[model samples]
Target chain A: MKKATIRNVAELAHVSVASVSRYLNNKAKGRLSEEKAKAIEQAIKDLNYIPNLAARQMATNQSKTIAVVVSNIDDYFSTELFKGASNILRVKGYEAFLLDTNAEQQRERELIKTVSSSFFDGLLFQPLGSNIKTIQSEFIHNIPTVILDRRLATKRWPQVISNNVTASKDATKYFLKQGCDDILILSSEVKIASTRRDRYSGVCAIANPDQIHLIELDEESYNYVTIKNKIESFLLKQKVRNKKTLIFSFKERWLLAFLPMLFADGFLNSDQVLITGFSDTKLVQTILPEARLISQNPYLMGASAAEILLKSLSGEDNSKNYEPLIVPAKF
Target chain B: MKKATIRNVAELAHVSVASVSRYLNNKAKGRLSEEKAKAIEQAIKDLNYIPNLAARQMATNQSKTIAVVVSNIDDYFSTELFKGASNILRVKGYEAFLLDTNAEQQRERELIKTVSSSFFDGLLFQPLGSNIKTIQSEFIHNIPTVILDRRLATKRWPQVISNNVTASKDATKYFLKQGCDDILILSSEVKIASTRRDRYSGVCAIANPDQIHLIELDEESYNYVTIKNKIESFLLKQKVRNKKTLIFSFKERWLLAFLPMLFADGFLNSDQVLITGFSDTKLVQTILPEARLISQNPYLMGASAAEILLKSLSGEDNSKNYEPLIVPAKF
Candidate 1:
């Protein structure tokens, strides 16, 4: 049997080929009547006509799709950021393609390369690598792009990031004012991400070298046993010294992992220890009502990134001088 | 400036046009030497060549892409499901496009219509509507589809869902065994989703009509004020009867919202109320350590769904009779 064509659908629907094309391409919003659109749809269904999107995309020079690449998908921060971007992109009649790198640098690099050369009109990236030149392919410059969350070493694109330094410094100051003599900072590897490094730098600026103690864990490989051993040793030492320690977590996952163990050990209720972190979900607040959290507005960041990318794609933003847009985090 | 073509890249790299084509189409694995591939890539970059993915897709007759449409993006359940599906899809050389309906039936219908007629190789849908015939276009039949989490009225497609009836029944029996006379079920609209209705039915099978009190809220519009007022009245009635009440929540979001409020109102510690619900996150366990949760393995469900879809797409599973694969939830 011969494959059904656009002309066949047009003839069966009793409409012009242009009408069927318009409906298929999603260009018949206000141009075609509802009755005509329904007839075309019905005719296409009856004829088992599947319009080749690749062919249509070539004709229009647009896929009406945007790609959002994040480090990981199974987290509150990633999902909220994606939701914010998709909310705006969807309103603009563009589909948002969410790509997850699983927080692997190699995967992030490959995904960026693949998405850059694909048919997506624009890209919103939350990269794991701090150096863009090392991670991104040359094809990245070919697409209109906006960076989200973390800043790269080179500022080639517009960025939407949280004020990690200010928020961390402010949180540290609050801890000091509360007479927190010892600060234990639990974080992922700081060198790979600007967000982590900036946050660590902020705490160091206010806290003395002796007052700060850092525990850096590789998130990909670190398990509960490792986390428990590291944290237990730290807490034991603090207990021996009778230090009033403030446990500062740089990521929500760290807090989630540590808090339960701390509570189980009866260390959470003791006056010698306090807890705080950068958390996107109310889960932390729900678990420990007294724990102050540094909340980054990921949704707003995602929306702003999408807005900038859309403007760039539309040729409204032609300036080469790109300013980093910092969304403040609340303590 | 003139546009760079495949011939220009081939000439610059001292390679054949077929080699350039193979590299552009991502078909160069083990086929092209590392040195030759590097030269081709460098030459393409030097000449500023951008390959048209649309044309390549047409030539291959495959986009190497799958669409995973869910009700919402900013949730643990949705994200885990997507991650599970993408983990498998990515390994099989396919890109997963995540589309969010935001729990809107209209948007779900429109998205289904658009994705069905588009270039996706398969679809993994967590639908909002109960009737597939009404919400889906006839074009949906043209694609290999798999349903996740929820079941539709028609069983035309394969589904990967939790054992909602069995889990809910087990939970209900546990609640009854605790000598609880009054049971309050907090759920979203029961009629709209099979999961909710199945859970409700499971509880109804064991508990007497008078023993159960249900509060149905529209998730899209419910606020703190409404939740508080409804809970206050329910508690007041339960207090008058001196009833031992079991608060059964059908969703993790509801549990998160209600737990904080209950604790604030000084009702959490009372011996009169026991809490348990369906939760995908460890947050609930962290907050209420003693609370028994019905945990659904969304990741497993998603992985299984993808496996089925992939098998169907590869023509490895040609059987018309598809058994609904049930991933059991834990209590």
Candidate 2:
């Protein structure tokens, strides 16, 4: 069989060769119409044409790749987010490279420096710290990046984040109305990430200061035994005080880790303890059918971030205002 | 701060600049002694030297990047595998790019063709189907590759896989000896992956043909309703026959998806059902404390594959014989 060429695709799609070239280069946003783009895509697919990516990369000075830097990769939330971004990037003729920082700030800084110096077209970052300065210091080459999940202290780039504050506030308000006065906010360290801080603030907004208690787990020292002991102590205290407590988890993994311990200790079925938190999967519901959950659609958040980054890469988004794109979480 | 250069590193380490260059370029296998290598590493760390990967790539015709092709990226098993491989590659100054096939053969073929024609230093592939022919057709450039998880029909490359057959057979034998005669093997499309096929064959070897039954779920249409209905019917049939049954799940996600349904329907605590299969996380034990699990250390398997690929890329492995390295799965 003969190899398909640009001219072949152009002739089959009934478009000019220049139009085909523009579309292949991802410069066809305003130059070509939707109908023409669809026809060209169909013609290429029908002809079984695989464009030479290496040749194209050299010609355009673009690697046609995006770097996705996440805190951790072997988790439910991070993997789903990566999957979402990767799916969109793949359809747009780009590959997403994952860089795991393993939730270490030093590693995150190193990775960001490496990514800034690398030959990637764009970046999707889920930063551990307030990374505006870290990014500004090394991002001299100005690779377009879209921040995911957490917000920076001062926004220098577009961000896609779940509505953590509103969801947590509303959930807390509901619990307050239900006459559950004592509230315990279980979270990972809240200083580094804006997500944890926002959720904590949201709960504190409606609850009494004296009635609210917070336990922050250092991620580096998080273990099954530690979590089990903490939860057991909390439950015992609640039982002695004869007070109903709402256990609000700031992250899904924390909830998943501690819920089993709660079940094992027979604390789940008691009327004194209630549960609610940020969950991304149905696994939480499967484990506790009646637990109120704040569902943050991480996959959708990742896809939206990728779309924004793609637009910025193509010069379609020229706005200077760096307003975040907030994806609402379900209560 | 003054920029650290190769000269500075060599002067600090009391070694020649050429030796430092060779170490940075990953060609210091036999040429540099262990003491010299350690000195060079410490000096580089002390100087905080960041090697220019782009310049090195241009000079050595090495991209310092690897492609990891997997069936799916969103699942726990795949993510764990990728995490392990990525960790090893990063320490070796190579970046691992993930290309998720989404369990599509056509997509896998396209990706393999792309990787073959691209500038990747090596490949770690978890292929679907007996893809020896598919790989050979486009592997004209002979990118050093290491097969992962599943085996190909022909031994064209070194493989790192779990001891699927042995572990499954031993577990099945244990259950058979315990007088659990009726066995239902639940899997996702056994014909496509050797991991599933080997596991199925292992169970078949231990169980009676008349008592063994296999239910294959199409991945595209996998859902709660379908899984729940299938399990309900199987349990009903076992109840009618008054026979004790063992439910063996081939993958972690499958067990996770259906275990909830089994628990909801009150089948978990019944004396008629025994559960065990391939699980990678402690979530299974948390959910069903008594459920026996065959644990495949996916992370270790992935790291082993990356190590093998790195050795081959550095020209340290000259053997032509492709012997498989089996990572033992715990039963």
For each prediction in turn, the share of the native Cα contacts (below 8 Å between chains A and B) that it retains comes to: 0.41, 0.17
How many pairs of residues collide in model 1?
A: 0
* Clashing residue pairs for model 2: none
DockQ for candidate 2, please give it.
Answer: 0.14
The value of fnat for model 1 is 0.41
What are the runs in model 2 whose C-alpha is more than 4 Å off? A1-56, A138-140, A213-222, A236-242, A258-266, A270-272, A286-290, B1-55, B135-140, B213-215, B218-222, B236-243, B260-266, B270-272, B286-291
lDDT of candidate 1 over B1-331, digit per residue (tens):
3345555777799986556656766654458889989999899899888775654554345678899999877667888898889889889988888888877877787788778877787999998756666655634445788999887765578988889999999999998999888789998888888888899998999899988888887756646567767877888788898888999999887876677556655566677889989988666776676788898888888889999999998889877766788999999
List the global CA lDDT of all models.
0.79, 0.78
Lowest lDDT block of 10, candidate 1 chain A: A52-61
> Which candidate achieves the best DockQ against the true structure?
1
| For model 2 chain A, the run of ten residues with the poorest summed lDDT | A52-61
